[model samples]
Target: MPYPFRLNAVASLFVAIAPGAFAAEPDQIPQDMNVVIVSGSRVEHTSFDFPAAIDVVDASRIQDSQMRVNVSEALSAVPGLVAQNRQNYAQDLQISSRGFGARSAFGVRGIRLISDGVPATMPDGQGQPSAFNLDMAERIEVLRGPFSALYGNHSGGVIQLFTRDGQGRPTLEVNTAAGSDGQRKLDVNAQGSSAGIGYVLDVSRFETDGYRDHSAATRDQGFVKLTTAPTAGGKLTFTANSLEQDGTQDPLGTTWATYQANPRANEIDSTDTQSPKRTIADRYNTRKDISHKQAGLAYDQQFGDDRLHVMVYGGNRQVKQFQAFSKFLQVSPSQSGGVIDFDRDFYGADINYAFVRPLGDGKLTTTVGLEYGHSTDDRSGYENFIGNTFGQEGALRRDEQDKLKTMDPYAQAEWQVGQWVLTGGVRRTKLTVGVNDAFLSNGNDSGGVSFSHTTPVLGALYKINPLLNVYASAARGFETPTLNELFYSGSGAGFNFGLRAAESTHLEVGVKAIVMTNTRVNAALFQVRTSDELVVDTAIGGRTSYKNASATLRQGGELSVDTKLGAGFSGRVAVTVLRAVYDEAFGKVTTGSRLPGVPNANAFAEVAWKDKSERIGAALEAIASSNVYADDANADIPAPGYAILNARFNARQTWQGWNFKEFVRINNLLGRQYVGSVIVGDANKRYYEGAPGRNWMAGIGANYAF
Candidate 1:
């Protein structure tokens, strides 16, 4: 009776009729096209032949857009993915793919994040996007749908970033930019290749007097990469990155009343007792400071039809935050604290072997891999006040040691026939988590939980002709509870060992078409049924608790098109429509209610003009989305939909082996006021994070090649 069930029937019927409908005729098949993707299979394949819904944001787009501050700047057009800049540096960007990670209050969850073959996401499926250095990024690949199960746990989808390697002659470049709201940035980099070695190094600093009061922040980052060839067929790459933030303020969310009255105002204290109820956030000073560093090495070798790949990486992160909690909540002995402190060290290693051999008039490629990862956290909480002074660490309320380890072994095979590609993969994942509670004044609460699951995937891609390709896939995906979710117990102390892993069955069908030499279109229909879906119970004072619900069903469709409209003009469009709802009721939740933070519809379109010489270009873009509920109850609040316009202009010139470029961009071109993100189910009733109005940024850069 509902949309999910109806969509399911339609998708099944389409798949059943695909064979005969596509077998009518055969045309000359084109060779490898212009696009190649490695995210779908962990191996390179043509875009149309990948049998998945994947989008590639190339380097030109990344560099030309306003992505230096946030990745969402370049990802607004991607279908089935919602990337929003919260404008609050404390929590980073809020990203969700088809309702998978909409509940994350901080960082990313329920998705695997990879950068240059190294895992950016820890074993527990928690990731921080602040560590991403987009200034040096080459491209970003987003993969959704069934085949993503091959990446192991938390594979609702996968976002992989690939950085460019040094090539051609040596070059040095510098960039500087400034804009409204006191925003400024400076970046310097050098890249080159010589002999048998290639190197890239970059350093940057960003500072902004944010649009909201008391929201200014500054960040510094450094990155380095090196590649060398030792033996005949052996290559090694080393990478290191670091980030440091200072005075990153948290403006916090606002209630509906406060938003409509004064969007820039902080949360007010109703019980202050003073004549004028003053703002609490400014008085208490909510802020977060972070430092992170990571390094990794990868080695690759080939022997005839067999290839081996090995990678090892490690990182450390430290965080300290001051919250806006009042002293009344600290009286309870069970209360952790208003201030949070964390120190974490993580490391991992991966090894894979791939063999390509002949099999029955076709080629068979088999891959076997082993992955191991471990992480340890020294996490603690303290009162936000010491005597009469607030915003300082007081008495220690909680201290604990949390550790997680995971091991996964996987195997995959692909058989390429005349016009069909068949693929299959399986992965067995084992996870162990434990906690040692050090603060035992109240009681001794230390426990652990273990989770294991075997996920499998099967897929097929048929090339009906040079103009069309169709694909279908089925898989199983599993996600374990994140470390943060295991921190506090619902009733008493200790880790929530009672929490269960969320599992899902995924099915998808898709089509890719090349209508003309310069026009491309892609579409996909997908459904997922998840049991033991994690639902939020409460969120207060920067802490949240989660519990499992009975089941949820999510069904969706996505369409994207890119075309060369006319002479030197190009256009693109992407649309996504989805319905995610609880299939079974738990407590006060009713079945068929829409999922929180996930809109039913989203769309984006863009048009650009550029000369054949590529010396000048301009683009106009528009984005829109439907309303979304703010909580599971579906009655607390609703985040209204919005439409926004953005524009960009660029020009470049070359003189004496030196290239110079100037660019400018305007966001929220209409100066529209809107809510950019929501804090789902906030117990404090602070739900809406407001977006800034029209803003402009201009920059210039120069590079010299020798």
Candidate 2:
């Protein structure tokens, strides 16, 4: 179907459902409106009254019948966000919000990631979601649109995970799961509160033989948390986490011909004369090893009608990756080689004070905050072959010391009175990046660049009635080039300081309503106009370069409806329609060309049933997305549009201080074949990454309390 038709169809479906849903009696408004969120304002407030696009995935939805290994599993129902597992653990998850981070070749960019009040993103705005410990997550709050600008640079959107605090009786739990393709997981956790102090600890390991050729991985994670009231009216929290993955194989993307021939086949290394059928991944032993550890402390104090909050965190990460670049590619002196090694240390702190007072006929709350972050990296690159032995580190090609520092000061206020709620905020951010070239054999390439921006946001919401709210918001935001993006120019030169930051203007209008007495609906229309938009210029052999393009425009609408069907049944639907394209021609990319990697439309729907005791449940889910382009010119075979079905069943039982739970799930129930994701602008046309056809997983858990 045409993109416009797909969008209209989704919109019409919502329109058809709204009238009947809103006909319920006014007195039947659900109490779910009381759910509090803190992502938009830095203070607790109901999402219904917050004038921005935000969604919350509670613990039940995050953990039930799931492997809990990747956040992508739980985020499909969130409109305006795309999270793809890639099925390649070596590169980590790919996440983009509203087309902001769609061009990312790896990891997460253009978005902010926070956990337990500490930033998971680095000072340069690159984040690794693999660091998150989902076993302890209580809820994940996703904030989009104008309000995200308040978080400073590269804040296209924000996703924050809050862990559950230990309380009640002490308990210990163990879980084990196994599935197709040799996938398996084991997890153990303990939590309790003693003498006014709370503690939680978790450890888990996951392994998979992978559905695609030459893709295999193993990961181990650990988390610890402690909470206590150290003084009257004051509470302190401490958290620590670690993640380790060694020798995770990377199944590089395949050419369209190869994918069509065999979705599970690897890209053959045509240059290998001795073994013609040997795949590039097998020939080069493409893989990555990562080790990461972090710790954070947060303290909050209440004084009458005011509050003080402070957070400090520090971490270190080490990574070694081997890429599948051919030997010929390294003949150029400017080439950074095929082996990447980096060790980084990072630390940051945030301090804020909130004051509350009465103004006119309303109550006003204001917060002033300061944030500082720093990171230093010892980086080096090496050739991937030594004496014809591929995959072994050869001669060193480049070495550098890279440092990033950021400081931001921001303030925001919220006032609520009668039927009106008003909010405004501003942030001034300064970022400095410096690189010192240690190996000058390829020529001295060292420099420093700094960027500064002041962003402001404003929003207003009006309560149309006890069951409905309408809101509008606007803001200015900016995204600076990440270290990876700046590492190489289009010509393969080192560190392109000429790259400019992308600045944007955002506008949004939305509605929040309770319908059918037991249903909640959120709908939004948004637009973003950006100058100096960052785009992929070239990609070859696992190395990608970025360049700033002409102005771009993104206009979209999002709708999410969640309702109770009674009889212990529920249903949910989330739809997104986005039109992202270049507004002006630039470098062969004509005006109106759709942005690569972003689909024109996507949707998710689910129907679930549970026993009255909530001990047995099942759900049927459908996920669909329109086709997406692979290049700036829209000149390649696009990943075809696809829809898939999934089903899951879970059961629970409790007996004398013990709890037992088990679940079984089947994905891609129809055994459809499709590409799950793409590597945009791949110069070699190896753009498609195939998803699994059909898969099953079963798990069981046992908990004991004392």
Per-model TM values vs. the true structure? 0.95, 0.97
Q: State the lDDT of candidate 1 residue by residue for 198-314, as single tens digits.
A: 999999999988877668889999999999988778889999999999769988887888876766666786645552466666756889999999999999898987889999999
Q: Give the Cα error of residue 582 in candidate 1, in Å.
A: 1.1
> Local distance difference test, per candidate?
0.84, 0.91
Q: Write the per-residue lDDT of candidate 2 for residues 10-66, one digit (tens) a residue.
A: 456556555755577665666664479999888888888899999999898889989
The alpha-carbon lDDT assigned to residue 329 of candidate 1 equals: 50
Q: List the residue pairs that clash in candidate 1.
A: none
- Candidate 1, residue 105: Cα displacement in angstroms equals 0.6
Error of 1 at 66 (Å): 1.5
Measured with C-alpha atoms, the lDDT of residue 379 in candidate 1 is: 90
Best by TM-score: 2
Mark the regions of model 2 whose C-alpha exceeds 4 Å error after superposition. Answer: 1-28, 330-336
